[model samples]
Target: MKKILVVDDEFDILTTWRLILEMEGYEVTTASNGRVALESARANPPDLVITDWMMPHMDGVAFIRELAANDSLAQVPVILMSAAAHAPTLEHGNAQFRRKPLSIDDLLDLVKHKLGEA
Candidate 1:
């Protein structure tokens, strides 16, 4: 199964995503803050990461920057989720952008596309 790390401060969003991904056959791990997300990634890197823009302690941009800077975790693909159109510029690699209020089909399509599946 593909592993996905979902980082978001909002419980409802996190829970909602976890359920959605789980139903899609993706192994989902969630973090409520960027700090925990970084730690979890370091401990057990996920194949894909979906993160919220605004977060406590560290933001999504900062988290990805740090992860990209690290050799061990730099290869992981990331998807940035936000209500705004602003997608952060990444140094290591590009990340997929998904806007807020995305439909289930849209989310699944993006996730599958990023995972290199049709």
Candidate 2:
């Protein structure tokens, strides 16, 4: 099974994503902030990461930079989600962007595409 790490400041959002992804047969892990998420990723690197742009302690972009800095985790695919009016600039080629209020179907499709299961 593909492993996914989902990070969000909102506990409700994190829980919702976990349930949705798990139901799709993906092994899912979640963190409430980027700092915790980064630690989790280092401990057990995930195949893909779904993160919110704005987070306490560490932001998604910073987390992605840290993740990419690690040789072992550098290749992990990431999906960045934000509700902000303007999207943040992302230079990583392995990253994809999605606006907030993301549709479950769209999220699943992106995950599948990233994991090459689509």
Q: Following a full C-alpha superposition, what root-mean-square deviation does model 2 have from the true structure?
A: 1.3
Collision pairs in model 2: none
The true-versus-predicted C-alpha distance at residue 55 of model 1, in Å, is 0.6
Candidate 1 lDDT, 1-118, residue by residue in tens: 8899999999998999899999888999999988999999999999889999889899888898888998989988888888986666766485766789788788888889888541
CA error at residue 108 for candidate 1, angstroms: 0.7
Q: Model 1: how far is 77 from its true place, Å?
A: 0.7
lDDT of each: 0.87, 0.90
TM-score of each: 0.91, 0.95
Clash count, one per candidate: 0, 0
